[model samples]
Target: MPDDEPALAAQRQHWERTFAARAGMFGSDASAPARAAALAFREAGLRTVLELGGGQGRDSVFLAASGFEVHALDYAQAGVAAIQRAAEAAGVARRLTAAQHDVREPLPAADGAFDACYAHMLFCMALTTRELLALSREVLRVLRPGGLCVYTVRNTSDPDFGRGVHRGEALYENQGFIVHFFDRAKVERLAAGYELLGVEEFEEGALPRRLFRVTLRMPLR
Candidate 1:
């Protein structure tokens, strides 16, 4: 909601309309990045997850079915509603909670509340570098010590990296949507207060965008 940025309300409407236009945006199966997060979480013996940008609840439902308690947040009310409906349909409503939440705002959960946080492409959303840093701090705040933050970002090497109008910083306004691309240095910088565990590259979508699955961990005090 910065003066130079798109209004938050407008952003919410954009996503709402995008979802309304189709029966589904993302399909029923969770994205590969999310599946990978599930594996990592299970290996780490983590149970509770806080998901940011939980569009349409595909991943949230999948994670809940995988036996994790999930709190899924999306900016658009439509998206949150979709999540709620999907959770009910999947009979994971007891394990899943959906809410409309803007990641730019402080997380609603209490400190040290979550064992892991997942975001498929939340970091690459149309947010300023400062906002990303603040969001990172918020993630650290809500996660217990040694908790993990697993997220994906369209990296500089992505096929659509330079396809749209450049927006001053690493951001590009592509087809009315904004994406802030990331590089390794940028990822590390945003993860300043956390321990950088790894960055794995993968291709997704018909465009096969080159994305980085960056994993960070909050240090134990």
Candidate 2:
């Protein structure tokens, strides 16, 4: 955390190992947020989606099946492979592509390459505020004007908040996984140049992680 490259490397390694050891660790269910995002993206008349942090590809398969061309990225190689396999299994491989990427770096897409962007829980990873800001800008750059972006993040109100090893900058470590928790102010901060269309509170998992489902739109200018 704290924008330290060494720490980020460690975090990436941890995730890589975890994903390698636990294929489909998150199971094959498309998250509730992803399901809702599909409808919202469809309603917005979106055709292409760039999905970040597509762990195991459940959302990738589902979105492709829902008729959206999806390009999914994951930091872990295993996760990216999982997505490809899931896409093939679901017979949506033609509509879905998977790649390994780290969001802290520049996105591997041209400006205005995608009609929409989606992320299930990528913003809450072991990322610093500065890194999150840069990532938001990258997401902005990759989207077409008026394109929508739907993402979810674990919020400060979550039950596990402040319960683990403090990693500075509102980040805490639990079970060897670091998470950068967001508050409403932080969410608004990242919405900088975009229109913050919606922020809805929701819960997920057995711990019932409290999160905010956020939607943003780029200006048509």
Candidate 3:
């Protein structure tokens, strides 16, 4: 099968290069958003989770350690390797699976294969608005009924919004990375198939990025 379309292939190559330059792209800690989702996962009795753009497997390892089966997907092979090593070291290898995947394509898992889905800044990773909408549908497709999808994205209120060169729509090419900042309207529009649970605003990093933690649940049939 084809790896990815031209645009997505370019993005994948960029992330691969980034990961190769450093031992690990993101740090070893699970993202705050992922940690926050654990409580909701517990409340819902979720067992299996599909994590998109799981850079270096930090959140996957954490989720697995927390007793949930995690399938962590990233575009970079190096990141997948890191996740595999981390899971083994954490003694959660049986509970964690890592693979290289591009979310721009349809998710490879069976329908309703996962009890929950998580993404940390995956929606903001240079994907176009249309691609994000398609991905939301794919996420919903792979999730079991009533499964929750939790994701974070830089919001339009972020301090860095519009600070970089425009890359079309709400996207910007900043420094060496590309970002597609979301607004409340865009979030709602993209998440139409699912029930919106809540949206929380939080800040992170030195840029003090304004981000939204969006929670959506597939309606029970």
Candidate 4:
């Protein structure tokens, strides 16, 4: 593990405990962003989706049932198992795959293996700026040319942006979880190798956490 990003390995353990404690922590419904992404994916003729941080499989089951081939990855073992359970219960097991993976490493898929990549608030996790950049490059690597990457992150406008214990590099810890806040410049910096398609701000949860939904695309040569 990299010394600078020490919080990540601990975070995996935190998530493991959290997921084990609460079976359906995020509830059964798919997030609004996932619903929106599904429509866009369908319209774009993208059939395969790689979902990162697929907590509890809310979006994984939804996407699979909606006809997109879904492969959901989460660092926590319990979370990954919950995804598989949810997929099986939804009868979408045939269409969905769940795996435990740390996104800090290279993505598990082959080059050009997916048609689209989606992650709802995954970018806002305990990852640092450098880790985010590397993860973005990995996303680009696994996507087919012209494939789309849709991800959301809490922005600087979020209510908890600077609250709680400060981790290095735009990250803050609340309770036991850490979040990395983003701004327009950071988004643009990560968009280096991809076409920046859109950046839309939205709100979620009772705290009304402010977030940005970023869409990027690999260019066709």
Please write out the lDDT profile of model 4 over residues 1-221, one tens digit for every residue: 22336665589899999999999989999999999899888888999999999998999999999999999999999999999999989999999999999999999999999999999999999998888899999999999998999999999999999998888778888998999999999999999899999999999999999999999999997
The model with the greater TM-score, 3 or 4, is: 4
**Clash number for each model:** 0, 0, 0, 0
Which residue ranges in model 1 land beyond 4 Å of their true spot?
Answer: 1-4, 7-9
Candidate 1 vs 4: which has more lDDT: 4
User: Largest lDDT belongs to which candidate?
Assistant: 4
Cα lDDT of model 2 by residue, 112-148, tens digit: 9999999988999988888899999999999999999
Model 3, C-alpha of 221: deviation from truth (Å) = 0.6
Per-residue lDDT tens digits for candidate 3, residues 84-148, read: 99999999999999888888789989999999999989999888878898999999999999999
Which 10-residue window of candidate 4 scores lowest in summed lDDT? 1-10
TM-score of each: 0.95, 0.97, 0.94, 0.97
- Candidate 1 global CA lDDT score: 0.90
Residue-wise C-alpha lDDT for candidate 1, range 1-221, written one tens digit per residue: 23346432266778888977764678899899889999999999999999999999999999999999999999988898999999999999999999988888999999999999999998998788988999999999999999999999999998778787776478776777778899999999988999999999998988878899999999999
What C-alpha RMSD separates each model from the true structure? 1.9, 1.3, 3.4, 1.8
What is the descending TM-score order?
Answer: 4, 2, 1, 3
TM-score for predicted model 4 compared with the true structure: 0.97
Residue 55, model 2, lDDT: 90
User: How high is the CA lDDT of each candidate model?
Assistant: 0.90, 0.92, 0.88, 0.93
Query: What's model 2's TM-score?
Result: 0.97
